[model samples]
Target chain A: MGYISLDQARTIIAAALAHGGQLGLKPLSVAVLDSGSHLIAFERQDGSSTLRAQIATGKAAGALALGLSSRRIGEMAAERPSFVASLGTIAPAGLIPAAGGVIVVDEAGRAIGAVGVTGDTSDNDELCALAGIAAAKLKAQNA
Target chain B: MGYISLDQARTIIAAALAHGGQLGLKPLSVAVLDSGSHLIAFERQDGSSTLRAQIATGKAAGALALGLSSRRIGEMAAERPSFVASLGTIAPAGLIPAAGGVIVVDEAGRAIGAVGVTGDTSDNDELCALAGIAAAKLKAQNA
Candidate 1:
């Protein structure tokens, strides 16, 4: 299992926040998980609505579980709404097929976890996740 | 505002983990949310899936937003599938209204924040959350 420490989570969050601040974006909610898709840490900025973190984590988990990016899931869902609906029935709440989540791959290119961001455009969310993964020296591991 | 700082969130997670260990539960995923429903922190045991935290937080946020437990939402959903479906459509993902979440109430009985736990039965999740709140000395902030 890819060991994920809280410190690393903090680093990823720090990077995301810095980037968001640079862009003058809205407050963001981020979720970071270990290689096994277990939570390492999370943070939500002030003024962000309660839904932000849930959405972020959902995107991240969807990537981790699917071994792909949530953006891919979004594309797939767009093509098959009914199937995605069934998936919602089976999956936990907040399983969005959005573009803000990407799987994290270790140095060996093995996916260990994922990072997700919310409270901005889907493109921005995905960008933040990718940047955090890169800062950690991990691959995108996106599908 | 039920100010649930990251430090408090960490405390809640530790309390939840210790109790879960004592109870011989599988690894748990815990979520702590502020009054605004934004996530303050989360932790998932090594073996837990990424979905746990998202599930737990949604359960807790649903409770806070509606001022009712997820259990109550389960019953309500059965009677109003359309309402629930629209909820899913209109709200970000993770809007499941289910059991296993408790509102953090202050001395004035105001709901300030909430803690949600998963990777266990709903009863166990609720117990762990209540224990966390107690350990944090954050008695139900708003009743």
Candidate 2:
């Protein structure tokens, strides 16, 4: 299975944090996970809340667990709250049905990893996550 | 980051139990955790509930996870029940929004550890936690 390297994970976190900074967003937290949903790297800005670590990890790991971006998971949640809530109970990392979690894919469109970001509006968080993936020259699953 | 030592953890647990005894409170449980929310030491007095161990750890670990005392979390839960409930799903050690959880801080105001107490009322549980921290000559967060 395709996997994310530690170096790539670090690069994603750095770029994500930088993007959030340039946008004047709140202190952010980022987490990167390999295809198997194991954390490769994580960082939370100094002023970020304590739960940022788990939230970030949940976003990315949740995306991978369901084979969809968290944005889509969020939509699914809106349509089927009970189903989604049940999934959260079974998902080891817990599923966060929100935006800002994006799967990274290789040239062949095979998922390699995921990145999750939090600290601002969900839209802004997703923007930073995408920026990080782009800066690393990685392809987002559907982009 | 500052962390709690085994000796200090033991001290905190012992003192908390003693305080509970002196106050004529019900059989109590105490837990001490390092900065990373890892358990350092734990104890349960005779006749304590079967779930006292998990409850004690949940209080302390939840405080560390949210960067706030469990009392504050309880307040937040009152105001934002759904938000706090979602967090509990993602939190690894579980988040219990009740009293008896206190974060230990260093002179610089950095979190070093946490103490949790449980048995009688939440108020009484918190009192013993404070007493334990005092006995250990450690500072409680915001104190």
Candidate 3:
């Protein structure tokens, strides 16, 4: 299986932070995960909420576990709240089925992982994640 | 620097699980940790008893914290039971000195992460952990 290097993970996070700043979004925490949904790197801008890390990781994990963007996951969860709730139990750490998680694809067109951003509006977070993936020269599953 | 991605962690766990099955060991719970001892991935096979997750995590934590295999920790504890008992109090969640935890090393022999397995004899668990690490082409610290 493919993996995301630490350098690449850092680059993606830096771009995400820069994008969020450029857009004047709130202080944010960004997390990048390998294709298996494990965290490769994470950072929380000063003044961001402590919960931002958990939220960001959850979003990335959800995206990778489902092979879909968190936005799509949110849509499905909205239609089936009980099922989504069950999923959270299955993944004790939690899985946020919302916007802000985007799968990162390698040049070979294979998803290598995901990036999740939190502390801003879901749309803004999603935007920043997409921006980061693009800045890193990786593809975003949805963006 | 090298790091263990979520994909690699999952692959390691899958291999460990398969090895356990081949040996007819009891249901198991496995955990993977980054170099910092942060969780990367985890799984608890169906039928594994409760607390297996915590046990697995503790084992991994102990290995990462001391740079020694859980088996070695157990051996040291055998000689100084009180010190090991004190360690448990310090950890709160309890850090078992038993086997089943191994550090994952990069090609350069730098430890990149750790894996912990629980649910069978400590020796058997260690065997599975070693198998998993080998399958991933990563070195196990105390196979």
Candidate 4:
């Protein structure tokens, strides 16, 4: 049951903030989803717009449900708009197929969970996620 | 605003659970909707039925739109079935004119939002919502 825990969730969020601030990024919203694609914990930085929280959640859920980062899904979604549209209705809340999610992997390269970060550029979002994964002392494979 | 935060949302949910459990009630779903009828947060207990969350949200939205307690609306719905039936469709997204919603007020006696609970009798649902309101230090008035 060590897939993830509250402590790890907090550490990851802290890293997101520390790294994001170091880069002078805007306030961000971050979410951690359990293997079941349900929200474990989420934080919307003070003064961040309301939509950031919802978008972050969607990106994280997208990663877990598709078993891949939303960045890759974004390309596929663009090529197959119909598929993405239908899936939006069928998907869990906050499952946006975009470039904001990164797979949180374990030692065996198994995808254990995922993180979604928002409040900056798409590249910055991915970078913040990498920092969070590193701070958690777990492996992350960019997708 | 300072009237509510995620911490307040979590605390209100805890109050609802404490009240729901004491009555030996079925697992319940509780929702808090902000003044604009946007979902602030929601929770369904582990054993709650799947549709409970939708029911709870609908109830909260109904209260906010009508500016009244759902319990009072339930009474009117019983006598004026036609009005509620028409209302059910007039507003988008299932709005059940039932007694699971109660207004959440700020210290200034203004309705800032509502809390709704479902998965038990109407009385039980109202009980949990009231408990949440009281615990959150918000006014539960005119419902």
| DockQ for all models | 0.32, 0.27, 0.12, 0.13
Question: Local error of candidate 2 at B31, Å?
Answer: 0.5
Off by over 4 Å in 3: A107-111, B1-68, B73-96, B101-121, B124-143
Candidate 4 lDDT over residue span A76-117, tens digit each: 898998887687788866567777788787777777778888
lDDT (tens digit, per residue) of candidate 3 on B1-143? 47888889989999999999999999988999877566899999999888998899899888876788899899989999999888877652357799998988887777788999999999999999999988888888744
- lDDT per model vs. reference: 0.76, 0.85, 0.85, 0.76
lDDT of 3 by residue, A1-143 (tens): 34678998899999999998899999999999876566789999999877988899999888777778889989999999999878877653358988999888766656778899999999999999988888887788753
TM-score (C-alpha, index-matched) for candidate 3: 0.63
- The residue-level lDDT of candidate 4 at A126 comes to 79
- In model 3 chain B, which range of ten residues has the least summed lDDT? B87-96
What is the Å distance of residue A93 in model 3 from its true position? 3.2
lDDT, model 3, position B89: 75
Q: Is candidate 2 or candidate 4 better by lDDT?
A: 2
| Residue-level error in angstroms, candidate 3, position A103 | 2.2
Q: Which candidate, 1 or 2, would have the higher DockQ against the true structure?
A: 1
Across B81-129, the per-residue lDDT of candidate 2 in tens digits comes to 5445556898777788899999999888888889988889999999999
Worst 10 residues of 4 chain A by lDDT: A38-47
- The Cα RMSD of model 2 versus the native structure comes to 4.2
